[model samples]
Structures are given as C-alpha cells and as structure tokens.
Target chain A: MDWTKEPEESKVYPATHHFRVIGDETFDAQTLHEICKEYDLRAPVEAGNASSGGKYRSYQVSVHFPDRATHHRFHNAVKAAKGVKVVL
Target chain B: MRIAIGCALAMLALAGCVTAHIDYPLNDVKPQGRPGVAVSLELKDERYSDKHSVATFAHKTGTYNQGVEFSRNLRDYAEVFGGAGTAESWYIAPDRLYWKPSGPMEDLRDRLAEHLKRAGVLKDAFRAGMRDPAGDGGVQNPETRGVQNRGSGATLRVALKRFVALKARRPGVDTFGFFGVSAVARSREIVAVKAEWTLLDPAGRTLDNGIVEFVEDGDGSCWRAKNKPFVLNNRAARRLGDELVKALRP
Candidate 1:
C-alpha cells in the first residue's frame, strides 16, 4: 500500500476545479456565496452530505480558476474561512 | 492572501479539451446496475497476508480423536473445530489475483465508487488493481505509454490476505468428546477477510493506504452451506466493500 509517486503538475486549468468545503451546518449557500463573492464569481454550490449527528456539513463547489495563482489563493482563502474545518 | 486579489494576473493558458460529465451514477443508476465494475485483487503491497499466524498449536491436522494436551491448540482441526465446511484459502505472492466484476459481485466496485463519490472523497474513478488505462492483459498495456487521459485519475485496489472460516472449540475435545455440537447451533463460516488497499492519485501519489479486515459470522443461512469457491469469494468482496468504505475516511 506504499505506491508513492510524484503527482503530475495540474495542467488542465481554465477548467472547473472542484473543492469540498467541510463546515458546520451554517456553512450554507449564503456563507459560500459571500466568501466566494470576492472573486467576482458565483456558481451553484451543491449541499453535500451531513455528518451522522448533523453538526457538520459538506459542500461541493466547482468554480472556474482562471490561473494557478487564483487556484492557490482561493484554496488558502477557503481553508482559512470562518467555520470551515477542511478545504479538500 | 498577498496573491490574486484584484491584481488582474496575466492569463495566457493553453486551450484544450475538457470533460464536464457530472452524472451521479449512484443516484441515476438503477438498482443492481453494473456500470464500469472493475474490482481487482492484484494488490500493490508486496507483503504476505499470513505474516502473523495464530498459536503454533493451532496448526494441528484434523483428527477425530487426539490426546487432550493443553499445549496443543485444537482450533486448527475439524475434529474440535467441526463445521464451516472447510478452511478458507489465503492468497500467496506471485498470484495474479486480478478480478473483474461478475456474477453476485457485479455491482460491488461501482457501488463502492459511488459511495466514495457521494462522500466527496474521490473526484474520478477507474478500474481497480487490474489496469490503469483500461486495457487487456497484454504487452503495450496501460496509458503510461503516452495514452491520453488514461492515467489521469485516482485508482483503488485491494488484495485478499486471509479468509478464515474456522469455528474453534474452547476445549480441545475429540469428535466423540465434543458431541451435540450441531453445525447449525454453532456458527459455521466466519468469512474472515483480510485485505490491503491502496488509493493512488492521477500522479500515482499514495493518497490513502490501509488494511481492511472483517469477519462475517455464520447466520441462519450460509451455515453448513455448500457454496462454491467463487460464491465465497463473491461474499468476501461484498464484505470487503463495506469495510473499505469505513476504512477510507475522507
């Protein structure tokens, strides 16, 4: 189970890069849109599955990142977003 | 925070084809649907499954009558460990344990993939351990040979380590000494499956790797059930899928 190889560089840019935002139940459509609004883009955010106790929720976002820098910036921003536990 | 904030970075990226297919096969597909079912057992881990054997005394041969030596483990023989039909076969090295979805386990891989997809753990799915580029078992195989979009996703594979189906008696008793131990009353087949799994990204990076082990105790059915070898293996696959899901936490 140790098949480790260097990951190929992400070349398919200007494409729909996906992210799963894991946060509390309050991380709903409004929170997502508000955080992503600074990028001047809005895409449908799919409210994903919830934890067994319903305390946490996960959302899937497929927005376009025009460049690698944008991708990294958006990833760091989401990771540091309030109430968000993990940006994967 | 100091990058890409209204800086208007120059975007001179190359134009290329892209796939925007976002069909939820788990929800859209019907019950028992077999789509892209590629589950193989050719594990990448080169370790032996039976690295840890039980008590050395458990390796005794089956005998209807043997001396009551506490030092000798009676779990290995059918005399004290009657029922469960036969012991499960553990795979060894150099065995090409590649498998394709068929028969009872036709929907196993697809279902597992969909479960992970629903959990958002995996973005793309491919055939399990068999082939990365979806090709036959021949020379010039796989996409590493310059085939486009073949090895551009995550792949998962599992290998069977052990299939223990033994029901041991606490006290080593001879067949006559251990009377009235009906196979029905006692659990027969404990389909103990030990499997190692590896999840790799598009670049062959090991995203997650772990071992999944579970035991299915004999229920009302399957007890003394004369199932073919393939049937047992199919059931093992089914159990392995569920265990895999639990082991693979995002």
Candidate 2:
C-alpha cells in the first residue's frame, strides 16, 4: 500500500491545511487576516524568516478546510493577494 | 514635385503592409461558476493617454478594447462556473492621472456594454440590471442591483493600469518591380497592458489583490494593419482574463 498516494475519497474531510506564502519584506499580515476572516477560516499567520538581504518575508498560515473545494478556494485567494510572491 | 511623387508612391506601397489579422478563439469555452458564490465585477479604464507614438512618423490611437472585453469575459466565466451572476460597471478616466467618472466615460461604457451583449459575451441575466443606468450613467448602487443583491459574495475590481500599442516599420530596398516601386517590409504591431485586480467581500474588505501583464503581437497585413490595436489588444485582454479566472477559481 502506497501511503503517499491515498485515494481522494480516503482523505478525511475538515482537515487542517498548511500554506506558506512568501512576499516582499513589506507584506502586510493584516491583509492575510482579513482574507481568512472572509472565508470564515481560523488560521494563525506566523512570520517565518526573511531572505539574507531582508528583501523577502515568509509567513506560515494554517487553516481548517471543511472540504477540498474550500481548501482550493482559500489557496487561490491567498495566491492572488497583493504582495504575495509565492505560495507553497 | 519629384519628392512629393516619391513620397506618395511610398505611402501607397506601405498601405498594404499595415494591416494584420488576429487569430484566436474569441468565444469558444465558457467557464463554470462555483455553486453559491457570486461575483460583481467593476472594470476601470485607468489609461491616461489615448495616442501613443511608436516613432516620429508612426502612431496608434487608443481604444478601450482590452478593458471592455476582459470585463465581459470575466462576467461570462463567473456565471458559467455556478456562481450566481456578475454585476458589471466601467469607469473610464482617460488623459488624467486621477479617475473622475465623466459623461464621455459613461457614453463609452454604454457603447461597450452594448457591444459585448451583441458579441454574445453577456447573457440576458447579466444584462438585466445593466440596461438602465443611473440617471448620470453610473451603475446603480450595488446593494440594490443585480447579482450583487445576493448576500455575502465576492467583488472584483479590475483596473487597466497601462495599455500601449506600438508599430515598427523598417525600410526595404526595391527589388522585383515592374516600374521601380520600392518593396516594403511588413510592419509589426505589439500591444501590451498591465492590469491590477482586487477581490473583496460584500462589506468591501479586501480579500486579495494582484497585478497581471499581457502582451501580444500582430504583423502588418491588410487584416492586421486595418485592425492593428484591436486585434493585438483583444488577444492580450482575453489572455489576461483567463489568468485572473484561474487565480480565483476553486
């Protein structure tokens, strides 16, 4: 059995999804909070480390996804937010 | 007299090489909307100039082709995707650094809305509330208007930051000719645009914001030269719309 390749239906619902968003050093944490609030998700946005030159900032966001669709929607919203450079 | 004749001949010869035709799928695929989500779209034309000079002798006049088409396609895509519908409005602020919605802007908006409807990009449902503009040509208040009336959905604000159309022509030597008519090289036109979009909730709190850039090219052919900016800008606008939808869809 390949644990890494579990079937879609086998995955549990209402799971916690972690997202890492990278942006410029000036990226606003408040914006991320507002976005989470809009989707009615509870996520703690924590600052990570800055690039060597301090030109970029990385933040870790963990939120509860009631379904796969909600998870994708949340990811998309974060991906499109201003000042966000990358999402992982 | 001789210089004038030479210039006239040159102009005549170059005329055929000015136009090019754009080939892309204009209305092929319609995106499906996400169930229970509605989007209200406001397209703002923020270009400050109407004419761009590629060279001392070559220039192109501006139009809102890209902005209008992008808004229309977005509206259609959202509706197709199971979203409730789209409330559409446009604000044109040409030749000014700041935006002030004006009479001409309102006229242009109506013309474009009608054009989109005729192109079949807008459905009847989307057109319902848009038909009667505010007495001043502004869109009716969103709270009381079309799809926006649906509770607690997304609002998309798309601003056209920059739109430029450039044409370059290089002289060619006379070669195969019956009467010394100089052969001309085909001129190429490029259209580029920068668009910024922000997604907000019903209460006007920003959910996300981002910018996208698009550039497309067409060469001088009878079709392209005649359609120059329209062909290139239309392609770029369509591509930009697709990118925005991908970024927003679940």
Candidate 3:
C-alpha cells in the first residue's frame, strides 16, 4: 500500500501521548526531567531498564496536548534534546 | 609498463567526465508561512519489491542510505518554519521494536523535542494534571474539541522510489603474484547513483517530487579506495536533499 497517499485515521484530541526516550550512559535523567517540566509536561517521567551493557537508559514520558500543534511543538522540542538518542 | 600507463590515463579521463543532475518541476504554489501548522514527517522505504527479502546488491546501492540522509536534512530544514513536528528517524530492525543495545541508532525524537523547546517554539504548560489515569487529564480547549483537524499545518510523507548505485569497470594491465618487479593494473571502479523522491500530504495528495542523479569516478589513486564510496554516496545524498528542498519550498 502507498502509505504516503493515504489519509490519516482520526485521533482523539487533547489526549495523553507516551514518548519513550533512550540515551547512552552519559545521559542525565534530571536534565531531561527539567526540560520536560519546562514544556509543562506534568506526568512524572518513568525510568525503564538499563541495557545489559549499562551503556544506555530508557525513559517513558507522558504528556497531554490540546491540539496537533501543541503535540508537535513538544515532540520537536524533545527530539532536539542533547544526549537523547531515540524517541519512540 | 606501457599498458599500466594507458590504464591510468583512461581512469583519469573517466574521473574528469563525472557530473550530477537534478530535475525538479516547479510548483505554482509559493510556500506561505504556516506558523500554526504542525508538520509531521515520515520516511518510508519502498525500494524492495518483495517484503520478505533483502534487495539484491544491484538494487541495494546507496538509495536507502541516501533516503535516510535526505530525511535528516529535511527535518533539520523544516525546523525553520517552526511548529509541532514528529519524524521517524530511528531504524527499527525487522521484527524488533528497537535496535539492539549495541546498535548505533539514537533517539532523535527526544533530542529534537528538547531542541525545539529550548528554541521557545513550544510553550510551557501548567503542571495541573499529572495523575490522570485515562491519559486525557490535560488542559482542554472547548473550541478545538471534536474538530477534524489533523494538525495546524500539514503532515508530509516521503516515499523513496529509486536509489540505485552502479559501477563501471575497465580492464587494466595485470601484474602477477610477484609484485615488486612488474607493475600490473586492475579494473578501476567508477560509481554512480540515481535517486527518485516523492512528497505527499496527510491525505496522500502529491505535493512535490523530483529525481537526482550523480556520478563519481574513483580517483586513480589506490590510497583513497576505502573512503571513495562513502564520499561519493554522500555527494549523491546531498544532491537529493538539495532538490527535495527546492521541491518542498518551505
């Protein structure tokens, strides 16, 4: 199927979305928390398991957006964070 | 000795003939400032004819790699317009939710989000609803509820059509196993790539598209062999990015 041409399915507005972030050992969770707070993300950031190698950590962040614009704004901001390697 | 000289000369001549071309059709619609439009970008790999197997060596070339490069460039470029945005920047292994811990992929979404927040494109919200079990406990605006709005601006989907890498070779003088005394030349590798790109909106409507082709002859020197393909493919990817930007406008 040509996904590029398909219309997006309807999504609930002002809904809570979860973003998972993975970073290397050098990553500081506190800094990320501060940044999330700055964006008005109220949910407590949840930390996940560290890789067996102890080289990386994953964090689950939940935030609510009133509209698509706000969601994107928050998304872009988190994507630009230092030491952040991936956002799922 | 004479044959080796001739082969070297031929390779030099081939290197001199390499060129790049970009073909983009201009769109009448000028890019207007959509400060409110939240742009979400997706990159899909369409290079494989069958979903089950890998692309053949001939079909693999640098197209997927270049597609990746183009996506990064597009995301960085799109940031200037400023709005809510998301991108599929990490490579998910087949049947895997995330890359194995040792793999090199980084979480670009969080990184980009942090950057945008710092830039002040995203506003800070009041920490009023932190423990909503339904995931719907945030501030809501009555005016926006029940509206069929996708985002403020538009969602862009880039489907990669073709990424082909080709090599041209010519026979050269050969020296036997005993090398130091006699000079023998081997076939020289000349590499080239062609990439096709298409841009679409959320509804699958075509926005803009283009094709870019580039060729690079291996410099006749063997010392640079290791880096030649990397350098050449990067050039091709950059060319593709340039054309995409032109087609996208904003």
Candidate closest to the true structure, highest lDDT: 2
For every model in order, the TM-score on chain A comes to: 0.71, 0.78, 0.75
Query: Each model's TM-score?
Result: 0.28, 0.24, 0.26
Residue B26 in candidate 2 has what lDDT? 14
- Report how far residue B238 has shifted in candidate 3, in Å: 38
**Higher-scoring candidate on lDDT, 2 or 3:** 2
> By TM-score, is 1 or 2 better?
1
Q: Which residue runs does candidate 1 get wrong by more than 4 Å?
A: A1-10, A25-29, A40-42, B1-250
- Order the numbered candidates by DockQ, best leading: 2, 3, 1
lDDT of 1 at B120: 31
> Where is model 1 chain B poorest over a 10-residue stretch in terms of lDDT?
B176-185
lDDT of 2 by residue, B199-241 (tens): 3222223334443333333332324433221112233333444
**Cα lDDT of model 3 by residue, B1-250, tens digit:** 3224223322321111111111110010102211111112211112111001000011111133332332233333222212112223222221111110110111123333344344332221110111222222111212113322111110011101111100000012110000000000111333222233332222223333333222233234323433211122222233333333343333
DockQ of 1: 0.01
Full-model lDDT for every candidate: 0.29, 0.30, 0.29
Candidate 3 lDDT over A36-85, as tens digits, reads 87554646787764543455566777676666567667766665777765
Worst 10 residues of 3 chain A by lDDT: A1-10
